[model samples]
Every structure is written in structure tokens, then in C-alpha cells.
Target: MITASRVFLIVMGLGFIVLGLNGLLNPLGHLAPYGLDYQAPGWMGEIRANYGGMHIGIGVLTALGAVHYAWRRNALALQLVFLGGLAVGRTLSVFLDGMPPTFALVFIAIEWVGAGLALWFLRSSN
Candidate 1:
């Protein structure tokens, strides 16, 4: 039977995969809510390659952690790093640029929650 932590990791992995695909396939639409509007093709390409690829990589690692005991710790570490970094960046933005949209706030919450889950699991295991 799968534990709650494993289920959380799997769900988080799937979430990242879906978001990554959306960013890769539709950069403009994916970034619209973030107030990012790039007119140049190069900018759009960069967004698709960088943001989308990053998320996809993280998703794959996270999913691997769910199935591979050897990879669980490392996968959780990666998740913590990625989500924590995002949460930090968002917090910085809120301080420097003022509050963002509701959707952005929602993402911040998700990031923090993901980071917290990863941290909790890591600590409990140790």
C-alpha cells in the first residue's frame, strides 16, 4: 500500500508535468496570468525552453522518487530546492514589486505547501 507521502509526491509530480506541458506548448497563454507578454519570438522560445524544461525535469525526478526507493531522498531534496526557491522568489517579488494577482498568490501557496511536504517527509525519514 502507498503511504500518504508517496501519494503526495506522485500528485505533485503529475501537477508539474501538466504545468510543464502547458508552458511548453502554449507559452503565451501559460504566462498571461503572470503578466508576461513577450512580442519577440526569441523571448517566447526562451520561455518555452527554460521554464517548461525546468518543470518537466523536476516532474520526472519527483515521479521517480515515488517509485524508486534509491531516488526518494534525492527526489525530495530536489523538490524542496525547486519549490523553496520559487517561494523565496515570490516572497521577494511581493516585497519589491508589491502584491501580485490572486492567481500568483495561489501559486505561492502551492509552492510553499509542496516545499513543506517535502521537508516534512525528509525529516520524518531521517
Candidate 2:
């Protein structure tokens, strides 16, 4: 039986895999969103492309990695830190962009809770 922690990790990992693939496959549209900023550096477009691909690639790899790190109980520290970082980024985005209440709340819900769950699992595993 999957423990509660394992369940959370699996769900979050799957979500990351899906979102990352979507971004990776649709580079210009979904992945390269930051490249469109006027304030972006001259090399930002290239950076954006590379970073987006890398992020997506990492996400995909992590999704697979989570099976061991998260689900099967290995590398919990690294996974915790990664998830914490993601949550922080997402939290910061809400403030910087100032999204609508519902949307912002939804993002907040995902970030804080999802990341919290992952972190909790990591901590408990130790």
C-alpha cells in the first residue's frame, strides 16, 4: 500500500512531468514564456530556450527519479530542497505578477500544499 507521503510525491511528480513535457514540446508558446519579456537580456532568448529545455528535462528525469527518491525512499534531502525551491518560486510569482484572487489562490494552494507535502515526506523519511 502506498503511504500518504508516497502518494503526494507520485502526484506531484506526475504533475511536474506533464507540465515539463508541455513546456518542452511547446517551447515558444509554453516554455519560452520568459523570453518574451522586453527587459530580457540580448542572450536571454537563447538562455530561455536552453533553460526551459533543461528545466523540462530535469522535471522529466525527476519524475522518474521520484520513484526512488520519493516513493521508494532515497535521496530525500535533495528532493525536499528541490520541492522547497519550486514552491518558493511559485510563491514569488504570485506577488510579482499580482494575479487574480482565485487564480492566485489556486497557484498558492498547489505550491504551498504540494511542496509542503513533498517536504514533509522527505523529512519524515529521515
Candidate 3:
């Protein structure tokens, strides 16, 4: 039962889990390179809650989708929305705000690819 979908779910889930944990444990170190810094104490809490908690939840749910048959489609849908949303937002920023950092450009490409894969798997499974 080691389908590509399962592998993708596991990989993406684990990746998000790691990222979430990093964001939680070291928000500044994790995001400071991206020009995001804590302007106030509340900023740390915000990043820890939104980026850390939300991503951890996403990761757990995604990994669950891999192991639970009933969750597969829903999990794929989650990937589509999450990755697609990021791509859309970033793309919009490029048009409205002009070019961003090279890293952001790279992230946009990766998010699109990930969203495409999620969509492909979602459709193929139907």
C-alpha cells in the first residue's frame, strides 16, 4: 500500500512537523533570515501560535491522512488549499509589491509544485 500519495503525505507531514517545532522552539532564529523579527514580545507569541501550532496541527492531520483510508481525500484537499493559498499569496505579492527575495521566489515555485502534486493525487484517487 506504499503508493505515491502515501509517501507524499508522510514526507510533507514530517517536513511541516519539523518546521513547526523549529518555529515554536526558536521563532527568531527560524524566521530572522527571512527578514521577520520580533518587534514586540507579542510577535513571538504570535509566531509561536500561528506558525508553530497551526503547522503542527496541519502536519499531524496530514500524517493521519496517510494512515487512515477515510482521511486520504480530505488530506489531499488540505494540501491543495494550504500550498495553493501560499502560492497565490506570494504570486499576488510579486505583482502588487514587486519582486521579493530570491528565497521567496524559490518558495513560490516549490509551493506550486507541491500544490500541483496534491491536485494530481486528489484527482487520480477519485
Candidate 4:
């Protein structure tokens, strides 16, 4: 019986997978309404062209990891790296380069809270 928390995490993870893939896959225009500067990074021009698949994969794994956390809490550790990475990336985005108010802030907050919860869930097995 998956509780509300599990469902929330699953859905949240699934959302990221879809959003990230869309941004990476559809580079013709702004995939995120708030806008993502894929070119902000070093060698972005070289990377962005071929990075959509990676984003999609991350998104898929994020949702799967959340489910793994819900069903098998121990597996949350596997995703900790990703959650931590996301937090760092967003922090860098906000600090080094300017980010829009809408999606960027939301992503940062989600990454922070999600990472914290993932850590807590992994620590306690009750």
C-alpha cells in the first residue's frame, strides 16, 4: 500500500523526468517556461546538442528512484548523488549566472527539499 508520501515522491520524480527530457529533446525553443540557459555552461554549445538523452535518462531514473525509495527505502542512497548534484547545479545557476524567478527557483527548492527527504528516508528504516 503506497502511502501519500510515496505517491508524492513518485509523481514528483516522474515530473522531473518528463520536464528534463522535454528541455533536452526540444531545443528549438524554450522548453521550460522560465527558460533554461543550456549555453551557460562551459562547452555548452557542444554539449547541449547531444544532451537531451541524458536529461531524459535522469528524469526516468529520478522517478524510478523515488519509487525505489518508497518501495525499497535503501535504494534512495543511489539517487542521493543526483539529488545533491541537482542542488549544486541550481545553486550555481542562481549564483554564477542569473536565473529566472519561476522555474529556476522552484527547481532549487525542490532539489533541496527532495535531497533532504531522501537523506532522512534513507537514514530511518521505520
Candidate 5:
């Protein structure tokens, strides 16, 4: 008996898991969208830790939420925080650092929309 909320949580969780795997396995390809490059080992470690480890950790958290009914709210909150944070940073970069590539712009839009949806579901569930 999967409700819409559970489905949403699963989707968000899987999305993060995929992103994390990409970051860990193909660090350069993951950063290619942003035209970011790193030549040093320390930077590679940072990328794997931050982008790879963090996203996977977050993904597991949301996936847990999908599994446990009581965790749904927390999962939604995670989504709100994660996606919202990304949207905010990207939006500020647009204003402060100048226009980013279309790839970033698209992500910004998705993040905002995803954050908004998370919030909506959170409120509706309460």
C-alpha cells in the first residue's frame, strides 16, 4: 500500500543515491556539467567526500523515510533543506557571480520546484 507521499520519498531518495554514485565513481564527469576541474588529490578527496558521500548519506536518510511511516515528515524536511539549499546557493551565484550555464539554471529550477513540492507535501500531511 504505497501512498503518494511514499512514492515521492522513494523518488527523491533514489535521485540522491544516483547523484552520489556518479560523484563517487566519476568525479570529473559529475563536475563536468558545472565546468569545474580539480588537479589536486585533496580536491578529489573533497569532491568524493562532499558530493559523493554527502549525497549518498542524504539519499539513505530519505530512503529510510520512505520505508518507515513515522519518518515521512523528517524525510520531507530533508528534501526541503537539501534542495532548498542548493537552489539558494545557485540563485545567489547567479546574482553575485554572474549568469551560470544553462545546466545550472535548469538545476536551480528543479531544486526550487522540488523544494516547494516537499514543503507542500509536508504541510498536507500534517
Candidate 6:
């Protein structure tokens, strides 16, 4: 039987993979909703390499954790770090730069939830 934690990891991993691929393949479209326009030279490549690569790396790690019991804890830890960092960064942006778009707020919530879930599973497994 698949545990809830494993299920969560798998779902999150796949979601990240899709998001990363989309960003990499279509930087303009992917960023359009976020109010970012890649009109300058090399901006698209920068987004594809940095943002997409980060998400892909995280997604692969998360997926590995779901399939490999030995890597599960470490994977959760990585996720906690990533999601928690994002949440913290977003909070700082909100304070320093003022409120962002609604989508950004939604992402902030998701980041917190992801971090919380990772923390919960990590603690429960101990």
C-alpha cells in the first residue's frame, strides 16, 4: 500500500516537472501570467535555464524520494528547504515591494502548504 507521504511526494514531483517543462519550453507564455515580459535579449534563455532548471532538479529529487525509501527523508528535507525558502522570499518581497498579483499570492500560499506538508511528514517519520 502506498503511504500518504509517498502519494504526496509523487503528486508534487509530477506537478513540478510539468511546471518546469512548461517554463523551459515556453518562457514567454509561462511568465506572461506573472506579468513578466521577456523582451530583452537573452532573458528567455535566462529564465529557461535558471527557473526551469531549479524546478526540474527539485522535481527529480522529489520523485526519487517517492520511489526510494532510503532517500525519502532527505528528499523531504530538500523540499522543506526549497518551499520554506520560497515562502520566506515571497513574504519579504511583499513587505519590501508591496503586494503582488493574485497569482503570486496563490503561489505564496502553495509554497507555505508545501513546506508545512514536508515538515509534518518529516516529523511524523521520526
lDDT of each: 0.89, 0.56, 0.91, 0.61, 0.91, 0.90
Deviation from native of the Cα of residue 79 in model 1, angstroms: 0.8
Better lDDT candidate (1, 6): 6
TM-score of each: 0.95, 0.60, 0.94, 0.62, 0.95, 0.94
lDDT of 1 by residue, 7-94 (tens): 8789988888888888898899988987889959899888888768778888888999999888888988988999999999998999
lDDT of 6: 0.90
Please write out the lDDT profile of model 2 over residues 80-122, one tens digit for every residue: 5666676677678778976645644675677666656666766
lDDT of 5 by residue, 15-66 (tens): 8999999998889889998889985899899888888999999999999999
Winner of 2 and 3 under lDDT: 3
Candidate 4 overall lDDT versus native:
0.61
Stretches of candidate 5 above 4 Å error? none
lDDT of 1: 0.89
Off by over 4 Å in 4: 31-51, 65-75, 97-100
Weakest ten-residue segment in model 3 by summed lDDT: 32-41
Model 3, position 92: C-alpha lDDT score: 98
Model 5, global lDDT: 0.91
Model 2 is weakest, by summed lDDT over 10 consecutive residues, at: 31-40
Residue 100 alpha-carbon offset, candidate 1, angstroms: 0.2
- Total clashing residue pairs per candidate? 0, 0, 0, 1, 0, 0
TM-score of 4: 0.62
Q: What is the C-alpha RMSD of each candidate to the true structure, in Å?
A: 1.0, 4.4, 1.1, 4.5, 1.0, 1.2
